[model samples]
Target: MEFQLDKINPTKAIDLYRGMLKPRVIENKMLTLLRQGKISKWFSGIGQEAIAAGVMQNLNNDEYVLPMHRNLGVFTSREIPLYRLFEQWQGKANGFTKGRDRSFHFGTQEYHVVGMISHLGPQLGVADGIALAHKLRNEKKLTAVFTGEGGTSEGDFHEALNVASVWQLPVLFCVENNGYGLSTPTNEQYNCENIADRGVGYGMESHIIDGNNVVEVFTKMKEITESVRENPRPILIEFKTFRRRGHEEASGTKYVPEDLMAYWEKRDPIENYEKALMDADLLTKDDQKKFTDEFNEEIKTHLKKANNAPPIESSIEKELADVYQNFEPKNLPASTETNHIRFVDAISEALKMAMQKNHNLVIMGQDVADYGGVFKITEGFVDEFGKERVRNTPICESAIVSAAMGLSINKMKAVVEMQFGDFVSSGFNPIVNYLAKIHYRWNQNADVVVRMPCGAGVGAGPFHSQTNEAWFTKTPGLKVVYPAFADDAKGLLISAIEDPNPVMFFEHKALYRSQRSDVPTNYYTTELGKANLLKEGSQISLITFGAGVHWALDVLENNPDLSVDLIDLRSLSPLDTEAILSSVRKTGKALILQEDTSFGGVASDISALISKHCFESLDGPVETVTSLPTPVPFAGQLEDQFLAKSRLEKALIDLANY
Candidate 1:
């Protein structure tokens, strides 16, 4: 490499040296703070500076870089102010997250850098989505993301790589193989010789590079990045390195062998580069002393400023602010003129209208582009819009949703479809943990609408048929919508697209083509966090959503003697307590119905709220009608029996008699 340095100028050598050294200085400062108990934790990138420094110097400014926890060097090389990094550690309001995120878990869109989430694998898909956006806009830029060698073992890792490979997305997947996944050694983690070997399985080009050599890392990374930007394709790079420190400040390097530690210390990227620069006469003793003196003074200034800055403000009140999209309630135009349309067609209209209104809105799901989705709800969408906008993705549920999150964090909106709502479990982490918490944690709205074809009774089996409203409702910062009417479906979806938040929309599979209504042809928005009064009665209030709304209405409509009010809760998360309590007060009885399993389901929350708020008005105990607690059986008979339709009828009869 020194023989190769004749062509490299002294300035380039110094740049590489500075890049590798800055992060080490920052790491030492932060670790010193940790020792003084000023900071709670420290995840040092002592042995891994060269990888990020090399990549950051070569990447285009507009391209995105999704760095993991150990990639502090990447952030520093991107020219993020040193004091801001200190401010983040000090938990100041001026930090990137405005005091919301308390640790080194925030990023700046202006710099095209995304900070790490605890689960590192999901960010790969997020980076892929940003690259996809560049491709769509014909921007000559790519996104680079890094994860640990251990992260490739997660399901999301494979899903993200596969999606990027299939789409030929311009994403660089760098695996910093530091020999251990926490305390677990690489030998125990995988049977493969190297993590890059798995790249071929995903149809991605693979390379293994010496991560400890700053020059080698820079030369290879720059070449690969240029190629990827020109001809969009995901590439996998395995950086062979060693962690010089423990996993965090709390965990010392007791697990590391003495000999292994000695070997890594000798090959330290900064030390090696400094010696090399001196040998080439590109750096001198005085130059090194100058940097050390300046860095020491700089650290003191930043440390004092950060410590004096106000600590991050945290409260229950701030958590709820900006959790939902800000919008003024606009009612639908009242007119007798309406077009009779299927529920599926109504959804299609909503998607079409949303996409037409905003060119940035893109849809992704399995079989959606050519096959119009499994249920044919998205039929003719590809013909109307190009395949770029209406994409048919692989069976990578996690990437599908996670990528939408990435797109949403940018200026774009994404409408992601889960072929069946039950399959959302495969992608649940990103939706529940990352997507839902974005706005609440950092005020970053992932403007994504996940379309879930939900519910059972059609005997699609346990894996395909499920009503998961309860799972999402329990999670704060997510908007759960399950509309009963085609008109409400169109309106709610439009509002969801416009709103700057993550929304989990449940479209009942049973009603896609079976249900029909005169949906409004004109543009409109149904207010979220509100309920539609389907029927008016003084005897009992039937509160339900999704398929159960129709089921409850049928039970009461046939029995004209029993007057019942049907309140269709369109929004599940922001529970329509105003409509619910008002109906219960007037009717004097409350009946909660849902297609989800009875135990710990959406109805349970509503029932508890009703009991607590309208207990005095109740004639008998609050009644809840729901399916039995079991996997939705494949056999039609068993599924029907498992669903408590007959039990609901009996419950209604007993309530009426009571």
Candidate 2:
């Protein structure tokens, strides 16, 4: 794209001037409010407004923009009302987040803006997902994601760029090189001459433009966005700008060199753009004054209305009510005729059936397409659904997980497989912070299901074998489903796919082929938040889930005289309190067994719940059997000691005799 200022349209030039000026005016007012204790915080985008203003003006309403905190121009250019933005800044009930989040920390589907979290890198991967969705649907839309120059140092930044380039997704990586990240300068950030150069490593188009020149930013982005929409590939644009203000109003710019600050002040984006517009005879001094006055008056009117609006206290109930979707467990009739299958096959069948039912469902993971996944759970999936649905992603956990959230933003469902359970730690930030909290923060549903092939017994060691369900069970807004039987696995997986919220589906690696049951070949759904009672007895209640169910069942089979009530908790987050309490109340004694370690495990939480709710009904103290708190070893003998089998048998006998 050639940079020809004379060729720029007068109307577009004026629109770009208004775009940059609106944010300059808004931020100045916000800074005043912050000083007066009217608003809590302010991340000033004063000197660097040209990048957002220019780029956002060229985008359509359908194209999504993931903006950082400093990109106020993005909201203004999208024509978001001043009053609503004021409400959001004021933490009023009528704000975009309904007071759940502050500042530009919320996404709004109405304006096609995906908000950024404090962790700046994760959204890059999310942009990949949104772009992936557009590519899959053959939509001529692209996603533009912004980050500071310092954000390029993040692992997610590299991973997102590589994945976007490899997949040839329609994404625009907009890097605003403001010289510093918080207090650290560019010299300490990266040794590269330009952030755009990093794009070359990813095999993508790259460009460097004057961030202070609104016309140049807009011109370059116009060409780049058009090319990406038509061709569908990633491109990186480095906007060389400076941050005149500190990271936030509270973080004073004592570290910024005085000479450098003075240089940026002279090359101010708004001042330079206003001059260029006037030079081109598109805007006059009087015209600028009128626009400034109108914007000021608009700000004043909106601020007054926002100040008068009720605080979060008024809508606290509604805010809490919107946290999770109210999905009642369906009581579908069980299948009478069935075919016996392994647990892994049941999940494959469920996914195949779900994809057949919902054309928008996508399954993504490493080697999931032709390789049939590391466990062969998705064998023959690519043959049925094609490569578009059965996506094979790079070794980027954080990117793929965050991408799943992106898919959900476009009303699409994504199933992400974490080759093994422990790998979830790599994707934890997006799962717990973004996917699990997006709904409560911005009323956006994260329709993502993460499949974790968890648990030990295959001698895969700590990295590959881990029953880490407890980590997500404690996180709110996430459904944790762990099935013990093939039938239950098929039903629960289908239900999780149909769910409008994020779900953590844990598939025990040991039970992939070991567990077999008569599962229905036809489509069916198993209710979440409901526990299944596999056995009924009066002596004691054995509460467990996943592989623990097999351990308990084996003990029951060996000791025929032992009267035990066995409960398999399919869902952990929406804990089946009634089922757990009822069995404990009937037996008057309870044992909580789990494959995860004892400390901070699901077993501990269940024990506390039993002790709190069924204290009077208990004959003695509630007992628990769990694996030792140690990293799983590869050696068979050491792994056995790390498991709960031997200790579970002893705990059952002790609790039974008591």
Candidate 3:
């Protein structure tokens, strides 16, 4: 695409300068605070300020921005309160997240800022989703997602880019090529000479620009933004720049050679941009000084306001905020409404019920419709529901999630299945980004259910036998359900489909054919934030969910002398704390067991919650029994060692000893 300089308004140059200056001030102050120990952590946008300013400058206030950690410049240009930004860094209740999210993770829904600082690559899919929403609504708004060149290596990047290209979404992907990613140089990180070239493979327009040059960055962004607005095609922007500082407060800059640092120092975006303005007769020394003074004063005022603002009285208020909206609670099926059913059959039934009730419901993914899914969970769905609702999609996990987000924003319920959960890494972007944040940001609900078959024991190798449930528990605004029995499989699936939010419905392949329970044939709904207490006792509270719930139940039954209250955590996100506390109160001892690795899993959250709320009531220290931090072995014997049954039994014996 050729640039059209005559069409660009010269007045925007001044607006762009003002926009760029604000972010610079914010970044400097954040660094100052971090150094002084007033803030525990920070991410700098020091050298790459122009790229952030340029992309956001071209976007309207109503447009969306889903940025990575170094997007302070973008938010600053959008006029997010600097003091609130600082407060977020300080971990104060008055911060943007009210201490819920880390400093770099702060974002505002009111400003159309969708995803915040999460792991790289996810926001690209979110930007595509926001753009998809705008396209569906016939709204004229573009979405720009910013990331570093290093993020290109993540599966999410390729997945999101491919979807946006295929969909012709009004999304502009801005990649800040800051020479290096932390300590790793981009040359070693990626094979591509320029990140923009990757877009060519996706058949999208791509642009490469001098990221330090404000004029070049803004002009290039404006051209692409206009093109996207006109035809609703996705664009890739590779902003070539440098990072002046380390990745975070604790990171040392000694990794970079002095020559490389000095060479990039000459290309300082702020200094170069100031010189450009001066040389163009647009801004003089006095004008720059005055702008700086006014900006500093504004920062002081914002800091005061943010500092004095009241603390978030309740951290758990927005805890279940995006779970569902504008949906009335439906009564559960009567206890008599029970019939013996298999897990897979129950899942299919749940989908049928959900589809029949909501016209917005849809089913898609590899072999999901005509092929009836790999495990036949969606068998005969296409014939029954027709093509529009039971769509047979391409074999692309990323595109599936991205398109689901589009359907979700249009108020359609999307049931996307990955032949197996192990393949979900291919589409992790949209799941974490758009699907999770659609409702949280625009207050526009995303009723998308991602049916993933997770866990091992089916002999599916490393590629097919992985459990990534723990990877998503740390993410907010996402509901992850792992059903233990056919009843929960049906009930939770039904509830997940009906709920106006995105849910990761992980059905263990091991249980799909092995387990059977009497599930309700009649329509029923399950609570999104409640735990099920299957058995009650006083010796210890056996806290577990999903396939692990069976092991806990088996332990309780097999060891009659070991009285244990079994709590099944149906929803992992909101995590029915009230029920957990109640169980802990009754049992006076608790043991958290899970099939996922012990490190960074649900067990950690359960232990933390118990310690905070029900500490004094404990009969013994809370116990956790989980798989060791390692990949699931392919061998049956080795797999058995990683299962929760053995671990739960050991934990029970230990709790009884305590």
Candidate 4:
């Protein structure tokens, strides 16, 4: 597309100049503050202002933009208050993150901006989710995301682009090739000629624009954004620019050649745009000076206010309170009428009913739509809910998980399935870093449930079968739920969907088909932080979850004479400490069981809690029965030894006798 100045009105052209000038003014002042040790740090977008200012100016106020650390103009162009930005940098409580995070790392729904994580690439996947939401709602809006040329190397970047193109999602992938990734030059970062060229591989239109030329960037972005709003497909635009300053003030531009710095200095975005505006008679030299002075004064005023703002108080209660949403446990009446069903079928029924009730609920995973997933949990779902609601994704766990976070941002609930639980390691960053931290970092609700089909019984080898719930149970702002019975699976899944925070719902593959219960047919929800006392006895409290519940039950059934208080811990993160303590207090002897290995497992934590709280009441040590510390084997004989089911039976009898 050609740069046409005739297409832009005088007001928009002047606004564009102001947009570029404001961030430059802010950056200069911020640099001064950094030198004076007033602010801790800064990522200067001094020469790269036009890319954010020009592109963001073309976007509607309602459209979402995921900006990187350097895109300070994205905030300034959105007209986010200068005081708030200053407060954020100064680590004041009045900022968007309330001093929880620094700089552009925090996102605010008020400004329709999704802040980038330090990892840099996950936000692209998040953009896919926001765009997916827009397409589902038939909204004439698109999400724009930014990254540096170095970010293009991440798997999330490829996964997001491939999936967006395959789904025809309306996303604008903006890559600001600022000639360096920190100190690493463009030549060292990528082998490709241009970042835009890779867009062709993903079957998307690509463009390269002069990022320093604000007029060109503005006119071109207006055309591209309009086209995307109407067509609703992903487009990649490479904004060719240079970093005139160091990546951050502490890291000087010593690596950049003097000639290279001089070359980009001559093409400075603010200076070039100012001259262009003056040439078009849209801005006078007097107007330029007045605008700079006005911005300078405005920034100084805000900086003074930010400096005076109160620092975040160090309160343990307040710090703990911000981790998760204050979700009151709902106690719905248990259904009198019930249907006997397998655990897998119960899960399918719960999802089907939830989809029927909530139109915005979506399910995404590999082969989940038509193949019903590897386990057939989502069988016939695509036919019932249609492809839009029951979507199938490529084998990109990272992208799908981050996309779910994106969906949550738009008030849409998402369920992401990992074909096997062990694969969650592939998508771990987005879940632990982004999804689990989003609520605490910003007040964004991550209404997403990641279904992990886990456990070892079918000889599916180590990759396919493994118990990994311990990975997320330690992460704050995430709910870890593992259900053993059919009815609990149905009710707990319903509750997980309704939750406003991120939930990791683990469905033990071993129990999916083996377990059968009279599950309620109607819509219902079970409280999250509550445990069920299956059998109350005075001898020993068998605390277990998932497959261990069935294993313990089998042991109890075989030895009817043995008295045991069976406690099924439904949720792990919000562990039902009250129930565990009550049962252990009554029994005097406690035995914790889990499918995960003994070291660093949920059982270890529970044992510690029992020892600390139940020291006076306990008659013996709190012993734990767990799988051996090794990967699950494929052979049945070796697998059984690894699972230690027989050990659990013996441990129960010995603990009960003690």
1-658 per-residue lDDT for model 1 (tens digits): 2324554677877888888777888788888878988788888889889898888888977778888888888877788777788777666766777766656587677787887789878888898788888888888788888899889888889999999999898889989999888899988889999899998798899999889988888888878988887888999999999988888868878888999999988888888888888887888999998887777788788778877887676777665665654556556553466899989888998898888888999999999998999888788988888899999998888988889988876678899999999889988999988888777566677889999998887878988888888899999889999998898898899888888788999999989888898998877788788898988988888888888888886777777788888899999978889999999999888888888888999888889999999888989879999898998888988888877565787887788778
Model 2: worst 10 consecutive residues (lDDT sum)? 1-10
How big is the RMSD of model 2? Answer: 1.7
Instruction: State model 3's lDDT.
Output: 0.77
Regions of candidate 3 where Cα sits further than 4 Å from its true position: 1-7, 28-42, 135-140, 248-281, 284-286, 308-329, 332-343, 356-364, 379-414, 422-448, 454-488, 500-522, 527-658
- Clashing residue pairs in candidate 1 are none
What TM-score does structure 2 among the candidates reach?
A: 0.98
Highest lDDT scorer: 4
Better of 1 and 3 by lDDT: 1
Error of 2 at 466 (Å): 0.8
Candidate 1 minimal-lDDT segment of 10 residues:
1-10
Q: For model 1, state the Cα shift of residue 28 in Å.
A: 1.3
How well is each residue in 1-658 modelled by candidate 3, as lDDT tens digits?
1222244455776677777787787667767877887667777778787787777877888787778888777677777777767667656665665565675664565676654535666656656656766775677778887888888888778878887787677888888888778889877898867889987799988888988877788777777788778778888888888888888858968988899999889988778767766776777999888988888898888878876777656545565653345576576764676889888888988888878887667787777777888898778877778765676665678767876765554445678888889888877766776566555443567678889898887777667877788767777768888778888888888888877777898898888888999887887877777888898888888888877887777767788898778888887876788999998988889899888877888898889999889988988999988886778788888888876666778778888788
lDDT measured at residue 222 in model 2 versus the true structure, 0 to 100: 83
Per-residue CA lDDT of candidate 4, range 1-658, in tens? 1235687888888888888888888888888888888788899889998898889988998999999999999998888999999888777787888788999998989989999999998999999999999999999999999999999999999999999999999999999999999999989888989999999899999999999888789888989999989999999999999988888889999999999999999988778767766777888989988999999888888888887888777688987888987787566666799999999999998899889988999999999998899889888988788999999999999999999999999889999999988999999999999999998898898999999999987899889989999899889989999999999999999999988889999999888888899998888998898899999898999999999988888898999998888999999978999999989899899999998987999999999999999999999989999999999999999998999586988888777677
Candidate 2 per-residue lDDT, tens place, 468-488, comes to 998998888898999999999
